[model samples]
Target: MRDITMYQSNGENELFVEQSVAQLPQLSGDTVTATIEIDAGQTYQEIDGFGASFTDSAAYLIHQVLDGEQRTELMSKLFDPQDGIGLSFLRNPMGASDYARTVYSYNDLPENGTDPELSGFSIAHDEADIIPLLQQALKLNPEIKLMASPWSAPGWMKTSGSMLTGQLKPEHYQVYADYFVRYIQAFAAHGLPTYAVTAQNEPLYEPQHYPGMLMLPEEQLVFIRDYLKPSFINHGLDTRILCYDHNWDRPDYPLTVLEEAAAEVDGVAWHWYGGAPAAQSEVLAAYPGKEVHFTEGSGGEWIPPFEQAFSNVMRTGIEILRNHSKSFVLWNMALDEQNGPTVPGFGKSTCRGVVTVNQQTRELTYTLDYYALAHFSKVIRPKALRLDSAASNELVRSVAFRNPDGSVAAVLFNDGEAEETVAVKLQGEEVLTFSMAPKSAVSLKVDSK
Candidate 1:
């Protein structure tokens, strides 16, 4: 008997439950229904990992709000592979994103202040809350990889002299590049090395309320080709450079940057706000080896229903990976029960984090987004190759991965309005069968033995 495990999140709006299925009863005498065929022969990209960001607010909530025991419990649930979801990937704002307590940068200077030498640069701000929380997570899972991006450059670097709606001045390019080098060095010193970094976050547009910088493809080409890449090299840093941390709709943005600066950059980073997941493939067609990383996406108030959120997250998660994203990273790891502690001036909060914290009582509730992410991060290990799988049933949106240990993990979501059960045929050999509830998701893991 082969050992198989299923982690399922069902239509009842509940969390995922792990169950053991001892054996597969083979199809008897010419089965009428179709089966899902898994073939490891045809494989795809190596998975870097899956997870969400630990924004300023997320870190604050975890580090300051929770008691010591509660903190350890929560961190374990998020990072420990044996005890929790085992999220292997994560991102953090280099400075302030909209979720920060206040707008600030590592190299903040007074108004009309300019430090071209960047002598005042320090990561003391992150040292307060961000680093401690990250240290705990790494303790739980040493293999976790971190990626970082800046929402806006220091106020001194932009024309407006604040972390607001101003473009980065051309002359400060070299110093800004130096800022990135310092950030990588500082984090690594604390035992948290950054695996990748983007030039800017959502570079195409500037926000009126939050910190933002308008950097176009031309500016990025010059910045990476002339400044950023050189700074990393001169410092002897191996951290990868990713460009165009924007939406799927603007494939041209990253493609344009790659047209000239491809050598200076390792891959393209995407967001889910605008276009189609298939856009990744379009970019891949032009530049085959360059990677695609879904760096930032948020599930929020607009789609508030639990079942709806589950369907969207799993379907989109599978679709993007199928299109060849090495990693799937969402926006926030945790938030207050109010959906925020967001930028103070912003009136309405729309985003839903993977988990929610009740600052008033300090209680935590894991959201469906958490379970949706678990279906992938908990089953597929880092560097696992995506295996080819074909589904006969239309509602069966399945993506399979072959782990480095030779086990197989296939995630399936039944988009239809009713439950469906199908046999799983592995490499032309019948192995197992499982049932999926409607508008729900299931992650199936098959042992090599």
Candidate 2:
């Protein structure tokens, strides 16, 4: 027998609650039982990490609304491996996202302005709250990786001459690439080294209200192959380039870019808004070596009864990983009680965060999204490999992993209407029996004995 810890979320007070260590029983002879058998010999993609984005609004609420002591406490719960979920992968906006307090870019210009040389490119705006909060997160977990996405480029580089709705001007392609280089260097100066960068955020849809830019796959191919790739090489930047930072509905979008510049582009980034996770697999089928990342998905107010929503999102995370995604990332990390302190009058957001900071009571409320993310992020460590696990029942979907620390963990989310009990087998040996409530989750981890 070996000591193992079980963390469960039954949609009650037990939200990722760690139960006392229990001894796991070994399988006896001639016992034939249905079980979820973990095969460590068959390993898939290496997990980069799991986390949510730290947008401008999230940083504002975390840095401005919460005091020093409160911010430390909250960040510790978010980033500390021992004290919290230990989210290691985070995404941020290079300029501004829809969740920002205002619609602005690194280099803004007057009504009819053009900086062909991109002389005024500066990330001074992020210095105030965004950079500091990121620095604090680094202190909590040194393995943290930061990815940057641009909602839109500076107004001068776009056809509409505004961040709201525009297409990148063909003449300023190299200049825009220069913008990315400066962004990486600027953030790196603050000790926040960027791990990866996407060409644009949701390049297909041009939102009339928020900052969005329309970029076709063909255009993105040119931007990545001719400009972005060469620019990185010229500057000797090791940061990887990921294409298609949009929903799963368009797997062909990333395939188009990878078809032309497969070597130049590193991977594909996806969102859960549109189609199914199978789209990720479709891309991987064509280019088996490329990486798939679940970059952004949000649990909004539209989904009610917090517990059920958590179950759904937790299921979505598992599905994404099973589809072979290296990382699973959600939308916003924190939002104000009003759902947002959004770009006033424009891009009004109703999106919920993992945590919410009440502007009125000045208390941080940990939402169901936080707990849903905790189940996977808390147990899965960086560089962990997903082990091949067979699901014995249809109602229960699960993915098992063997972390780098020599600990084996399985995260199971029950989607059935009733309770489910399944035997857990580790490398052909029955280790434990788990009974999970419907619309609930459980994480069982066994340390090296």
Candidate 3:
């Protein structure tokens, strides 16, 4: 019988994989064996942390979040490094999102007149989903970074006085800034301080079907420089400001805003909806100094099942690496079969979720999306540096990381049908052949020799 073995070493440990070369053992068809090893002097990449967010709705649907044992279990599964992926970053909605049961903001339907002095304001409305999720997340990973973005502003602040298709009234610019300050302060008071805030989600698209708003480039610049940034500074808040929480097709939007903000804001956040992955490079090229982030993208019902699984993983993992993004965040982590808690309700017939929660059984099964996320999150620890690597669009997509321990982690994906052999080159002279399954992904960690 022919056999094949794959070995990986990190200065501290060695990992080996052994299996039969043929599909099955010709003489003895009943058995198969595998071996593993750990060695010293070799190191892998240092990890930052890996994690998912607790959106407004996930907090409510997860029946026992506040309970101590349940909270511990949830936190452990999502944040504890030994037991879970140890997620270190989260994306929170400044107000309610499509995931919420209804549409509402902190200061909507105000009891008093809209005042810039911040008389009628509070995140009391978010106590339902936002607070519980943040508290639980922070408890699990105290170093977790929180990113807050609004799906829509308070209805009264919009042009139509509605959550959909309304732009912020120019007169309310300062008031809008105070709106952010109030939310940050309120959240901090609850022991869940946020790390950053995006001006708006999909600032270009106003979903009439769901609770969404539109903010123009000029308006965004005005808000960030004239309002948001200054407000944060005045309040002595360290929460950072991020611009352009939209797609790559509009790189100029954020670039212009950045030119206007002129270092007042921290970075640029982009989503994938309008076009190809290369769109990210456009932004990076224009503003090389600013950090680029892939804030939101996910598998939806429209794509076929096969493509969904394969593309989602490849898109998020390889695309993010290709674009030189700082991080990648997916939409709704968990959802029921029906995809409820959606604001105006999901437009598509099928719902997308990484982990489909079987309400009756309370069982969680990993979908293509989950596996795709795990391909990176499982191995590429947070804060892991994106080292240099090479791959084409057709053969295999990969990114290399230098771990804290000096070992390296490389995640590779082969979307083709036939098994493909890839050449993995590390350091200067070390090279190995890596064979990946058709339409599969493999993460190899090579410790420093």
Candidate 4:
């Protein structure tokens, strides 16, 4: 008999640990309800972990608003595995993102001036708020993996000479690469070394208001193969470079980069703003050697009643992991009551963070995104491999994993209107059976026998 710990979420039970069953019924074909067989023998991509981003706005809320005890409690609730949701991965902005308090970059320069030598490049802007918050987060979970992505390069590096809408200038490729090297080195100096980086965030779409830069597939390939790769080697930085931080609508973008600059790139990063999650699997099927990562998704004011947010996030998370995404990241970790401290002209005002902090009262409210993340981040440790699992129908969606510690975690979602009695079978043995309430997400963990 194996002890099984079950955590469930519907509307009422928010990641609630409903029970701890000590045994399983004898395997009998007639007794089995809906059997979800977990095949540990077969494994897929190694999971990096699950988490959300530490955006500028998120960091600001943590640093400026919350008191010492409240901040400590919040951090513990977020990063502590035993005490809270063990978020083992995080995405950091290389500079000002749309969620930032203001628009800025590391290598800002005066009009008509060029810093080919990168003498003026500095991460000083991030030092004020972002770094301190990151430092505390690292203190909570030293093993957390951080992946940085820049919304835009410095104005001088772009053809438009502004951080709004433009493409990276061909002449500034080498210098821009150097800028990345310096950014990584600076974060290391601050004791928060970056683990990986995407070349650009949403490279295909460049918004006219917020910080954004358009870099087509061919342009990204050249930048990686000729400039970024060599720059990392020269600077002795092993930070992995992921390409095409864009939507799934066009698989050709990443496919082209992989076809051309595969040697220089580590993998592909994708966002859920447009297109289907299955596109990730398409890229992986073409290049099985490379990795696939779900970089950013968000929930906010746009979602009504909040429970729907959890269901949506859970469905997306399961779909992506089932499709071979090793890492899953949501957008902002924290935001104010109004869903911002957003920069003027930046779209997505309705986009809320995983958690909302009251600027005036210093109160924190955890959204469905947090509970949805907890379903995965709490049990699935880094290096856990995706195990083979299947559902009987679309109403019952599931993805299983074999943890590094020899435990198996299966996350199941019952999207239908009626409760589902699921029999989770391991090696054809009915290990446990439970009723997953309708419109609920549940994670069941069992020790390997």
Candidate 5:
């Protein structure tokens, strides 16, 4: 038996851990109990220490799994305070992705105008599923930052004249720019203001499956600097434009675009399917001031209880954290047990979402991804910057932050096979030291300097 205690550097407060493991041989299970001890003079991090964001994947999942009362309940869990993920950011498709039931874009009709202008364009295509879902999400967290990305432009705008192509016709440059402006304004009118928009999703790849369009680095630069930027300004839209909405494997795409266009774009977004974790480091090295966001990717197709062990969640969570990502938005928020609402001719594969909704029982199944995200979302609140921390060689990784409330918040994880001890310091003073359990994540809150 060991005694675990946490203390503040100023010697003002202390917390003690209390444990009560079952003694019965038949019912014994591995369990560690943590107890909090507070001294009279102690202060800790504020409740709004960390923030998180969510995505539009919840809508399709809700439609497929729950209906009416059931849908509302699940939505609350995603946005409501009692159980909501408390998301402050959301990612929505400009048109349709593989996650949607069908494929379509905001302006997917045949039309032509040299430097065509979208004077009468609207978002009638997304009204069915994306709109209603976004309204409910906003109702839950009005502060949520919405981001829009086009899986593919309107079919007619591409050189291939289809969603699955690698080029956008130069003839429609002005029209395409107007298309973006219309999208932002339309979504805003619906009470869901988009905070950001990416030039093109996976711009480097044109899939023959679902909706996808590839835009070259030069094309992106021209579109953003010469067309999109001017269009946004003309429309008086505040939504920021992000470039390179693709995988880490092609950091050069965003790098080249931003390096050449300079201040034309606000930031760069990356996906996780094509490259290793270290790929972001290359981009970060080149563009330090720019924001690097992990916009999409799912761990796998299932969420098992054992997967909750740090190796699966904590390990990967730390990797993303260490990569200098301001935020991490997983692919699907909610999905049916079978993992679908899949579009025809998309990818040859499917993956799991954060929450698994049982259509038959009206029961909600939260995955390791959900728990892992909660560990950060519940404690790290939005706009919180990554501070600093030190840990061992095991799978555990840690990051600290100085909260606006004059307190510090630190998240530590042990994703390896054995438990380890960690020491945390705030303002160069040792405040607390604790032995992290194997396969577990813990968040420490302490008063700021």
Candidate 6:
């Protein structure tokens, strides 16, 4: 008999696991009621994992506010598969992001000077909070994959001569490429090696207050093909390069890069702030050989009523995975009560992290984003493949996965306000029948026999 482990969400029971139901005889039916069909035999993208970012602000909260024991507990909840959500992928900033305590970069230079040799490059600022926090998370889940993205090329490398808005100077192209090499080497020296790196964060959007560099598709193509690729080869670094770390609204950016510098890029990273999730599949259809990654989206102070936040994340996870994205990552792992320790005048102050740590009370509160992420990260692991699954109607949405252990995990979300009775059929055989609460997310796991 195959046992089923189910987790349900209403309001109070956010991702709460219900008692397991013992297996029963498979039902024979010609006409089925509401049903979700799972075809494990048909598989799509191989999942890398699901997770959030580990920013300086988040690191500060973990290191300064939480005591040693509390820190351990929180880290376990965030990283450990057995003890917590088992997030297997993490996004790291190459330097300061809007979420950082202060705005800075690894290679800050005087306005009049440029670091052609990059002699002054350093990651000293990260050691204080970012490195230690990452080390602790690694201890909890050594297999976690870290991908870094730069908010801006250092001030001197840009035309603006500041960390804010600027474009990379034409002459500094090779030097900027070397800058990335130095960053990878510096992090490796500290025992935190990055697995992948995006060319720029929100490449098209350059804000006036914080660190941002606008790299047009043509410029990015030239840099990757002529400079960055050669630098990586010379250094013998195998870190994967992802392009167009921007919104789905601009699929042409990635498509253009793929057309011109396909040899230099491994995949495309997308942000959900402006486009539809289906746009990812469009890119995949155009270039089936390339990968699609959903890199950033978040729930926070700007999001209303916790339930809506939960639903938004759950819905997004289902849609992206169904659309061929191998990985889904949210932003900001943790933050203080004020929604930050954010860089003033840089980004949205109302932005929220996955979890909030009260500055005064030093207490931790897990946001809806945490539970939303847990529904997938807790069951679907790294290296798993997305199995084909389809709901009978729009009211119910789901994505199925075949794990390395040969088990099957299907995450289902009910959109309606009333309860839903869903009969799950595996390979045309009725495996189980369960009721889903209105506006709930569920992760159903079953052993493959």
**Model 2, residue 141: C-alpha shift (Å):** 0.6
C-alpha local distance difference test of each model: 0.88, 0.88, 0.66, 0.86, 0.65, 0.86
Q: Least lDDT summed over 10 consecutive residues: which range in candidate 6? A: 23-32
lDDT of 6 by residue, 117-220 (tens): 88898899989988988888889988788899999888888899888998999999999899999989888888888888998999899887778999999999
Model 2 off-target regions past 4 Å? 21-34
User: Which pairs in model 5 have colliding backbones?
Assistant: 15-37, 50-380, 50-381, 51-380, 51-381, 51-382, 53-89, 406-448, 407-447, 407-448
Q: Per-residue error at 85 for model 3, in Å? A: 1.8
Better of 1 and 2 by TM-score: 1
In model 1, residue pairs whose N, Cα or C atoms come closer than 3 Å (at least 3 residues apart or on different chains), thus clashing, are none
Span of 10 residues, lowest total lDDT, candidate 5: 7-16
Preferred candidate (lDDT higher): 5 or 6 = 6
Per-residue CA lDDT of model 3 for 1-449, tens digit only, reads 11222222111121122223344223321221111122223433233334444556566656432345554565566665556656677788877777776777777674434656667677776786557767776776676777789988887777878777789988888888888888888888888777788989999998776667889988999888888888898999998788988887777888789777867877778777776567677766777666667778766666766644555556455776667776777777666666545775556435466555555665554455555565566566667776767553355666677666556666766656666556555544333454555655666656565
Q: Candidate 2 on 5-96: residue-level lDDT in tens?
A: 78888876779888764543443433523368889899999898888988999999999999889899999999999998899999999888
- The list of candidate 6 runs beyond 4 A from truth reads 22-33
Range of the 10 consecutive residues with the lowest summed lDDT in candidate 2: 24-33
Superposition error at 27 for model 1 (Å)? 7.2
Model 1 — which ten-residue stretch has the worst lDDT? 23-32
1-449: candidate 5 lDDT, tens digit per residue:
22221211110121111222223123111232221222223332122211222323456557654668877776676665336656656788877777776777766665542225554466775675668877887788675678888888787878777776657888788888888888888888888888888989888887777788878999999999999998888888878888997887877788889887767787778787777667676777787667666677676644444544324555555566667776677777776666665677655445767777765675787765666665566555665656645553535576665445545556666656676555554554545545665655666556543
Model 4 gets an lDDT of: 0.86
TM-score of each: 0.97, 0.96, 0.84, 0.96, 0.81, 0.96
Steric clash pairs (candidate 4): 300-352
Off by over 4 Å in 1: 23-34
In angstroms, how far off is 405's CA in candidate 6? 0.4
